[model samples]
Target chain A: MDTLNAGSVSAMLPSAFPIVDKDWELADTYTLHFATDGAFDFDPGQMVMISQPGVGEVPISISSNPDVHDRMSLTIRGSGSVTRALGRLDYGDVVGIRGPYGTPWPLDTAIDQDLMIIAGGIGLAPLRSLIYRALARRSDFRNLTLLYGSRDPQSLLFERELHEWRGRFDMEVEITVDRSSPEWMGEVGLVTSLVDRARFSEADAVAMVCGPEIMMHFVGIALTDKGMHPDNIFFSMERNMKCGIGLCGHCQLGAEFLCKDGPVFSLSRIEPLMKVEEL
Target chain B: MAHIIDIDGLDGLIASLKAEFDVIGPIVRDGLIRYGPIGSVADLPRGWTDVQEGGSYRLEPGNTEALFGFVLGPDSGKTNLFPPRAPMWTYREGSFSATPDSTRPMAIIGLRACDLAAIAIQDEVLLNGPYVDSHYAARRSQLFIVAVNCTTFATNCFCTSMNTGPRLESGFDLGLTEVLDDHHFVVHVGSEAGASFLAGLDQRQATSDELAEADQLIDITANSITKRLDTTDIAQFLADNLESPRWSAIAERCLACTNCTAACPTCFCTSPVDTTDFDGSAARERVWDSCFSLDYSYMGGDPVRSSGSSRYRQWMTHKLGTWIEQFGTSGCVGCGRCITWCPVGIDITEEMAAMRAEVLAKEAR
Candidate 1:
């Protein structure tokens, strides 16, 4: 065997990941599984490109935790032409994977610090990976809380995991909906509303919030009101990321490419992009 | 970095260079003089003109028997050097396929100052940014550019605000300002290729008076522009005007057809789509996409900027304000095609003026 040098290590890297499984998560939304040669490594919150034959590629955030599985998972929403085509894929179909790209969630940074995560709708998909990673290394962090909100009760994802996470006294998981029926027993309001009900020290605490921009804004405001510093808040941005490698200029927000510089950034660091009109 | 050549030797210089590389220049096609290969000087459009203003353009036949007639073309030099769409790689049978050869040496002639500046800006974005666009670098290395100072500004042109055009300053192998009165072009040799090209021409040494005339001409051309944008505090303007009624007004007339993006010189937004063939073969395509489209910002079965108002706001904000914060320059080149092709004639300069006036009115109140 070649002495496991850069060339040898690179040769073993998974350049193309084959689609082995796919499932519809909701109407026009999908969860796709790709078989990578176990050597393929990625941290949670990073995204991979899924390409369809004769159609095009769409960047899907890795929904599954990287520490536990040999196969990588991507949660994609059908909106544009590419995702619309991906929504039609079945098992054993193949899609190209470009990267495990972008700055991974600072799971290592969150160690020993209390964590508060707020995810809305599909935004929960990327946050779920971080949540799972946090659970895997639960002893490393102090307090863990997940606040999730969606359009309705039927649209909630990973319902079983939410129930399991709630059982642990060390962790708290709250699910809210914009609108709910009588059968729904959880909180009945936006995810931002749940912040007041949780208890945590603003010092040595960080909040990783991902969701609709408007929802994230409201959540950030709530966190600030609770004495969380802007530097302690993090959010993942969503743009029309055509090329995950930053070549296409589509995902640019101020000098940063959401693909290369960050899809995840501190609220303070990305303030310019947030303040700018289009980004 | 090499020898100097006189201004009169330009035609002979291009002719000599044609033997070694494909020489392309502006030619009349599709109602405009767009960049394409030329066999001889006769193939160039002799008399053409454009009426331009912010976001507006109209072509008219010109009086002077000049080869390059239009003020600026719809397509910038980008399509020649860095095409709108290109194949990165193709995968087949569980393996990657080799992309076709993208290397080629070509000489581009009659590139306007604004277009040349736009190319330089793209170089910083695509070739010299954090991650180099290898494809663009390959094309950029093998190409030669001959910059032409504008004789007149189009009505829609606003390169002055962007500090881009009406005069050629840098980033060219050769620069030429048309001076038909004396049947001479005041030329400036900027590179070795330019020096060699000028060596073959029958030209006279440029005197201080001649150079001064060129300066005066460039000043006149710059002043002829009918449009100007105050971009001094554009980022702050957009930030403050997020809830401005102008966004809704613009959206009310917008069809979201994306024609403006198609004609824009700096709009580089795109989206990828995939396709499969029989026998399990597959390919992915990089297609030009616009943020003006309603679906460009969709996430999780819901659209961000879903309303037409939001989409229009995104487009204008990205172009005039956010782009500056991102690329260190306003994305507009003052080419004026976006205004001309807007279908609804939603001029960007007018929008800026309205916003400026609105701000002033509020301050007065």
Candidate 2:
């Protein structure tokens, strides 16, 4: 790991990135689009540290398309202090940005195979990048299906994009919600139920999932139950982290630092760990 | 490669190092022998040794005037290298600028073998990662280590068990073995800087017999360590025993004081905090955080490890078990600071033995 001589990749100080646009995805969730300075780039599943000047930093996955140069979008929910501050920012306001850290979604592994992107709640944010990349290279794979679930129809992220994706002839998009409103025309049930109902070549497909830890866990089980190989099931996990690199030990799950070794990990690597209580 | 230097020669070596670097060595501070700035040999804690036991550490006058007689205090090279509080960057208006490393190049004198090993572990974490910590890298690049092989052992000292020490194998500028009988040091120069520094000291090549004496001196402490940990499949064992009842027992006695982690050399978890002033200049500072702290593992609402049982398990298992898988080596150096400084005397070795005993007892039945 003599990466020091490779080049300086220190994120000690974050560069200022201006918020070019802000989209309120939901009541609390906002997709803040930033004008990248072209200093660095990131992959679909890789996350960046977004910080407010007075508030602290939080690790948020890249939400927008990787091919889209000049602008990077981060889908953030106003849950904590840093994120809440980020939610309050408007276009032209500047915030500190460090990163594009952690392992990216193994998108190349999905080539020539069916790609199933399963997302729950805010989990869709990380997979949105992958969806964009996959759609761009649609001919490379056999089938591309997205089975997305939210708490409610109102809480659904990327509503406009989901609408566009569903209208596309090449890709398949199925939406589900736990509870339904009068305007809701989608299926009502757990995302796991959506996984069972979805059609895909399970044995040949690679499923990328993200959400709450428990949600991801059950989704992994659902994918496996649907005859998908556990190894083909990749998850973008979230944990408490300070340093997005492996320095801070907060984001540890067994031997893996979710910040470094993952944000994306196959079910084969982390299944045993998920079974252990409070691990 | 080796030199036999008398007491004055040792003093002269210190003087030479002091001239070039900000030399830090053990000195009596606040009734404890802690690593502090050493201007001269007089500043060193000579003729003093620490009596370390489970939940107790007392420094007293020893019979011999050995400069490096004591084992480790609460602090290690980590205290200086990866400080408890380090300002990373400051933000004003929009842009962020890193806090400059204005501190001088440092040379540590009397660093034990465990301390060196622990620094190496930290190097793997902070330096060998995908993104190197510039502050640690700067301090590490400018630092010189003068490791002293253990000639005496404390009750709490168990470096031999972990195979880290009693003898300074490498990772030092100069390695010293204090020959107690003759009041001289058998110095082993490990680097070009050490060789250059030794050229200025009043020293002579150690004879075959003197080298044998130094080996014998190291062996005395090495063999005296009664503390042992059976690390055979220890990682898997802890991984399997996560739900073991020992956690319950530990939770009963464990205070969750974070004393063990604070004293530990390889425990490198930190929390970044932001401070904003009236003038609108905000700074992000890193503070040493322990897993025992309720908020250390906070994600959204409640912390990951809320109970005392879970926190203790997290610390011990990570240090002895999962650390190997994480860092390619065991986290614990067996310096025994965790044992000695622990208020309830919660020994890690004893806990591991208890867990093993429980499993073995089940198998036997």
Candidate 3:
């Protein structure tokens, strides 16, 4: 019976922010950076509902490092009308930004545990933020390793950051591609194949994975087969959501509202529903 | 304090209230009694009774001239509180702004016990969550309820099974029950506003005998409903039987036409639809969307629940099973609107029994 307060009702409206910079990973995918107006802080792995005023809205995970406040970024693929509209925007062209919402990676739990990260295609966007945080406290985490893959040598995202992390002595980085070019000297295979070479403490290891739905499922089995504890393995779940909160039912996966309870869930938590087809 | 008011006094009360607030009540339209704005006492559906069962609703002439001679109609009080289409906000002239609250101070008449429970469930879904829905909050802030206790039953009614009805316990401004045999309504003033409104209307203090009659009448309604649904471990039962063959059986008849969800008062799922004008004005409104819709479960490519069996499973399991995990309460009030409005007579209670029967048969082996 609690009624609305004396003030006006709060609407879920996004403020238009000017795109300060843009980075292209490929012809169809890019990332837009913005300067935040005020104090807006979010944990890694959280997403924002990016909108083109007249086009539409799409939920995109925040890719920029969480350590830096006052600056935000969303790496979007020009796959749909709304994203296409956002992709066309350049320096100073404004787009509405609505959140930094959803649960973040369990970085606190992974402390002192050997960390293994797996990402495919644009899936590295959210994990990229986590990687930055993990590297910031490198001594706190033991044996940090990242295994990443893409469709081809030409399509890997964050090429500059990948090169930087690859050269670091503290972290081990392995990259692969489904279809390789003649000039490509790195490993050429599905990301799961790279799991055979990556090493971690099997008894006290934590793995964070993100990719296509089917890819995540197979990678989960691969991680478990590699002796990683099922409970310690986490992956992200995606669904089309209109209202970034729990009200919109589009993002439902069985008992989970991916928008709120998680877009990130432990493998053990959703394994049953994932086994059931079309749940 | 409860007061006794005859039909004429009741009419006067409605008239006075109409002049002050926007009063809405049940009206007969398109051969169906639905909630609409009231102009006078004549606007209320009187001298009419409805025969409601699975997939059937027929209005028949009533033997009594009493105003509340009928069971509840299809529209639950949910539409008045959380409307089917609500505009969230608008964007124009280089800025975004919230949709202005244009709703008037309003009163809704003839709210039944089952519908009131549904409203409370929606209140939890929209209000008591991690995020509050301001659109529902605005309209709900200005609502006044005139709850009418059920004195009759439709064949599909099972509020007694859900433990939600036959007598309203709370969440109403004013409570009423027509003692048809005694030709008077005992009004229970539930709020200070209700007491003040009644002071201006014609009414007398109810004698002890009159209050006793009201209690007995409500008791009769509770005892008369024959339909029953056993909710013993229903949540776990449905969850355990996720792949139950009973779902496929129900799906064969379920047209996926969304009639059940549309008639259900507590199905609060919605999807946003945006519109833009040539003058650079654009807005977003959330429309009531059904789980039965093929696109509701879409996750990029083909919909997650493309088959009818999975869609029906999503609807029923979400209502009976998963909702408990989400909101700590089953999302059904047992008003039986889903049963009565379904085109194929798909009854949820009957389906649950069938699923249980299948499990029982397996155990016996």
- lDDT tens digits, residue span B167-276, model 3: 98888888999887768889999888888888888899998998998988889999999888889998889878888888788988999999888889999888777899
Q: Which residue pairs overlap in candidate 2's backbone?
A: none
Expressed as tens digits, the lDDT of each residue in A131-246 for candidate 3 is 99899889999999999989999899999999999999999999999999999999999999988777888889999999988888988998899898889999988887877788
Task: State the lDDT of candidate 2 residue by residue for A131-222, as single tens digits.
Answer: 99998889889899999889998889888899899999999988899999999877999999989888889878999998888999999998
lDDT of 2 by residue, B1-93 (tens): 589888888789888887768889889998788888988888988889899889999999999888888887998999898889987888888
Could you tell which candidate, 1 or 2, scores higher by DockQ? 2
Give candidate 3's error at residue A75 in angstroms: 0.7
Docking class of 1: acceptable
Quote the lDDT for B355 in model 2.
94
Determine the TM-score of chain B of model 2.
0.98
Off by over 4 Å in 1: A1-14, A20-31, A68-70, A76-92, A108-111, A121-124, A135-140, A148-194, A212-218, A247-257, A267-279, B1-8, B53-61, B101-103, B200-204, B252-255
Question: How well does candidate 1 score on lDDT at residue A10?
Answer: 19
Better of 1 and 3 by lDDT: 3
Candidate 3: misplaced stretches above 4 Å? A1-11
> How many Å off is the CA of B33 in candidate 2?
1.4
- After TM-score superposition, the amount by which residue A77's alpha carbon in candidate 2 deviates from its true location, in angstroms, is 0.2
lDDT winner, 1 or 2: 2
